[model samples]
Target: MSPRFLCTLIIVLGFVSCGLPAKRREDKTKCPHVKAIRNFDLHELLGSWFVVQYFASSEEALSYGCMRPVFSMSSDRLEVSMNFTYTFTDDPAAELLYGNITWEIPNPSRPSHWVHAEDTYEGVYNTYVLDSDYKSWALLLHCAEKSKSPRYLSSFIMSRQPILAPNVVTYLREKLPRYDIDLAYMFPMTQTNCSNTNRESGLDRDTVRYVIKQSESNRRHPMKRLHKP
Candidate 1:
């Protein structure tokens, strides 16, 4: 072969080799398993839930005992309101705090939802799974997609009180490890007061009582059919 032709052939082969696609790398990290329960009774799930304990992220400022978020159920969605107080160690009395949160359903068809503080466009998206019995505990995983650090996320183990029953709290604490949640900075809402009247005024007391009793009955006898609205 001619030297010029040989050089041209070598150039062509090198270009083709460079153009070949690189091998695709497999992602070893397992995606989070978001468990979903088939039956979630919204009525029993309603009412107010105090921030029992929460797992804090590095970016979150240490909250004073005054901060708490309340959850209540509407017809089809959940409403969340957060109120908090912040105090610096150097100036304990110079505390500053603000209150804000979004109340919306994940979407009628989707299990996930977005919770915004003031505007719909801005807020964290959450994936939640509730216990089968709706006894007063939930797992919340929140991701802030628009944050400066795109991968920012946090998890919380929320309950109805600052101190849950020993057995129940132990169960919840144990379950956190299975979900890759860190319990090191778990802050309990020790100073917050839980109000029993919150749920009474929203729905008719008689109606709420009837539903709770019916739910209890359904649980007792699984064979019986529970009417769904």
Candidate 2:
């Protein structure tokens, strides 16, 4: 196929995968989380975190590498921002990609739970800290819901370093099933060669658009998990 056709197809696929359908279907996947850690310390949670593992209801495969997010909290501790760097797992060159996500704490009493501050979506999107020890590891859950559409859910096992103890990982994974997460779909993120990825990022216009578009599309209509049991 010609480059033009391939690019056109990619654009079309992005819309089909990410765009909401005219008629919404009932969300089959179950996700439930009403509260986050009580009296959460914003200062302790601030800093850099390595995304050690990831799971999403729509994901068909593992997609990122060298995934790291440096977090910053506002003075009042009401807003938080994560400036992240990541590279596609399949990219031979491992060209870095960057993005940012900001969240607002709706309830000051529950500092661990937050809602998306940006209008990335039209409806409610929540991020809850299921568990965290501040200096070591944290388990986070995210759920996005649109009117009459399937809820999009994803989880992250993050650490202060590139690796977390297997026992700690086991302890963290146990909390997910109650929210309808399949342990099998929770895949580790590769951190090898990650030390240097922060130094650079460059891609052609078409390639960048495709990659970013596809990444966004995976939010709702992902293909499948990268690892199969």
Estimated TM-score for each candidate: 0.52, 0.73
What is the C-alpha lDDT profile of model 2 across 179-225, one tens digit per residue? 87898999999888764432244456567566656666433212122
Clash pairs for candidate 2: 60-224, 60-225, 61-224, 61-225, 61-226
Q: What RMSD does model 2 have?
A: 15.4
For each candidate, C-alpha RMSD in Å? 17.1, 15.4
Residue range 103-189, candidate 1, lDDT tens digits: 455555433443443444333445454352456676555544344433334555556555566676667677665555566655554
lDDT per model, in order?
0.46, 0.75
